[model samples]
Target: MNAQTVLASSGDEFKAPGPELFEFPPLFAGGPEWLTKPVVFAVFGSLVVVVFFWSAFANPKLVPRGVQNLGEVGYMFVRDQIGRPFLGKNTDQWMPLLMSVFFLIWIWNIFAVVPIIQFPIASHIAFPAVLAASVYFIKIYLGIKHQGPVKYFTNMIPSGLPLPVYFLLVPIEYLSTFILAPFTHAVRLFANMFAGHTILAFFSLVGFWFLFEKPTVAGFSVGIIGVLVTIVMTAFELLIQFLQAFLFTMLAAMYIQSGLHAEH
Candidate 1:
């Protein structure tokens, strides 16, 4: 079913879905205003990640089968592709964190395409901002712990440069590493999911509005095109959802690696 059915159905005039689509009122009247759909789904997304892995790994198996097999494949992908390459010996140590981030994000994105509950949790900047901030702090903590406090901040500014260059380069590097890193990290995911969700709702709305809601001789052809585009865009969006999750997790691992090895 199309999510954007009628933006506003006054006199049969069509309206486009906007930022209002991302906002939700309380699920029930008199409920807490803050208890919105994305909040509930964010908690649900976390539980879904926890449950799937626990069910798969909580039991020992000589030969993997069912969700265990599926779980292992996902586990190994994060471990090998994401963790091992950058983290090296610290890979297994960080698997739990890396796996959680990857699967949780992938599932959150999946919610956008799900029936009825079609909101992407990460579409909201707050969601990704929190995750990115957690990583940012962890990166700072690990950097301080591994490389001494003085050394950690100092290492961020490279050596062997001309003294004059340090005045300009030092601030830029520090800002990029400390501030802009997390900002971009969160925005990248939020922007992609936000735009993708809006685009899907738009095409779906177009098809529904033209096809059944207000069918006409000329609009019939346009409706068909809208539907075909929706199908194609959906496929593209699914791939994007998975890729964004992987990229976010990969970058997290890279940040962790940088913390462990200041030279990074």
Candidate 2:
């Protein structure tokens, strides 16, 4: 699913939603080009995360209940599953960043299914790119700071590799670890959200147009099928949204831990 276009035709023929659906019109004529729905949703997504955790943990509680209980569960999931596996004893040092990213991303994706604000902030690419770039730079800076610049790259080479094999492995290692890693990291989440939203919009439109806009006996079954598919995809997308958030944060923790220690 792609989403970036204007209407191709005004004819009665159904026009499948594409990249165009992702594009938002300006709040006012001649407004700043960057001012769009995605940016607004991104900011809102951040606020939601901040407000939620504050409400959950601002005051001391002898026994957690309601939001605190939920927040504790989320915190443990991040610490045990995402942070501890990679950072081990160092997990606490990075919990703030990991929790922020995990919750922010999950909320941003959950927005896709949310009414009134039905857009995943990461679907726009710029948001994920910014987060991934931050992690990439942090990884590099920590690697050089902790291991020394020379040792940072040198440590990447496995000890058992033969002398002759070093030539091929060097470029491959640098390309994969340094360059492709961040690129894929951002794109993985963006692509999943983008595609998932497009799919949802397409089927929802099908159901709406067939059932409400222009109804017919033959079209009724098609509309029902469209509605069923949308329902099924909605459930599947929610699981994916959670998984993508976990995967993104887990990769982030892995990158940080690798930076602090040598690959060898």
Candidate 3:
């Protein structure tokens, strides 16, 4: 049955947010396939990143002002927190890419709490998967280039182990590095976004359903609790979004650094 029939079937019923909450129908509905809310937001997020940096650094101020100052703060945060710790001396070269990744993921995530654009782009698995795959490919390429193909595999597996142990350890190490690394990288960001958005939706829907849709003296207290929970969760989700973005970028840097220097 349709949504109307479902709602109509129940009298004074409240519907909790579920997977259906995340399933946004096409924006165009009947028009182009590519035009959807998530796609638009993703593209908009990218443009915002580019334009923001461009505007920030467009005019070179000696001391810094306005957007330039904020831009510098973000740049230093990524460099000092993520790039330097992971890539060391090479941080300068990778700063642009790292900063872009950090901000893009962050903005995509922050959109979840933004009014009207109440969906986190990273909640979609594909978004994180593509980024993780890109980093994975780069990691493999760097490893092969720095250490020859033969040495790369050798270094990937631990040394000083008994020869017999290779049967068990080598496959584990191989699968962990070559396969599970990327899989986990993507899933970590996606899972956090998906779960965070779901929680926010749940509480928000609770407040709306209990207070606005079918309010009663008995349910008023419950609705207040829902509103309070939504507020609390939104604040918490903000922290998670920033941390997730940092983590994704940090892991990318870690993978690249690992590729540069083989483990003993």
Candidate 4:
């Protein structure tokens, strides 16, 4: 059968439940399928980030130049604002990881607007989950490296609290910081991107649907409204794109900071 016929037949399969704006279909739909658009977009996004940075920084000029200057400013922002404050003595060691997270996230979010490839990879849960896990692993490793295994866990919990309070607070703190925190961190970025993209998709599709599907006086008016809403949502998504990337990097740096200062 043709594409439209298949979609029409599988109404139940394609229908999105509740507030989920986009249903799984059209290959690009965020789903458990083998080759989703988000996954492909993520792979391309990684390459783009790598190539862009490499081209910008490969042949460094003593005097600042085009892309290199812009890149240096970004690096300096993270180093001076985020890494140096938290990492202090060991800032240089962790700079690469922090920079990677920031750029990867920023590139992925920016892809939401670029012409043909319109999906943001960070919208996928798996991508952010992996990033969060990476940061968590690094934090744990740092903790172990600085203070031995026994002391690491001990240092994690605050010392001044009473014994009874320790019993409740310790586990809660551990579970929150160690267990639940990473997943939530990943999901926060994913959910925001996913929801934002879905809204844009809904408005854009509805606008076109009204323009073509009916072609009446009221339909024309509704189509115009939908188009306007889509434009507004697109503008909002642009802001969110930058904000989410900044927030993700900021939180990652904070998490690293927490690990560094766990002893105090």
Best by TM-score, which number?
1
TM-score against native, each model? 0.94, 0.93, 0.93, 0.84
Candidate 1 lDDT, 1-264, residue by residue in tens? 232333332236667789998989998999998899999999999999999999999995999999999999999899989999999999999999999999999999999989978988999999999999998898889999999899999998878989999999989998999889999999999999999999999999989878988876556766888899999999999999999999999999999998988863
Q: Candidate 4: where are CA atoms >4 Å away?
A: 1-33
Inter-residue clash pairs, candidate 4: none
Q: For model 4, what is the C-alpha lDDT against the true structure?
A: 0.78
State the displacement of the C-alpha of residue 174, model 3, in Å, after optimal TM-score superposition: 1.0
1-264: candidate 3 lDDT, tens digit per residue: 433343454455556678886676778659776667888999999999999999999896999999999999999999999999999998998888899999999999999988899999999888899999999898999999999999998988877889999999988988998899999999999999999999988888877876888776666666788899999999999999999999999999999899898977
Model 1: per-residue Cα lDDT at residue 139? 88
Candidate 4, residue 244: the lDDT equals: 86
Stretches off by above 4 angstroms in model 2 are 1-11
Ranking by TM-score: 1, 3, 2, 4
What is each predicted model's overall lDDT from 0 to 1?
0.90, 0.89, 0.89, 0.78
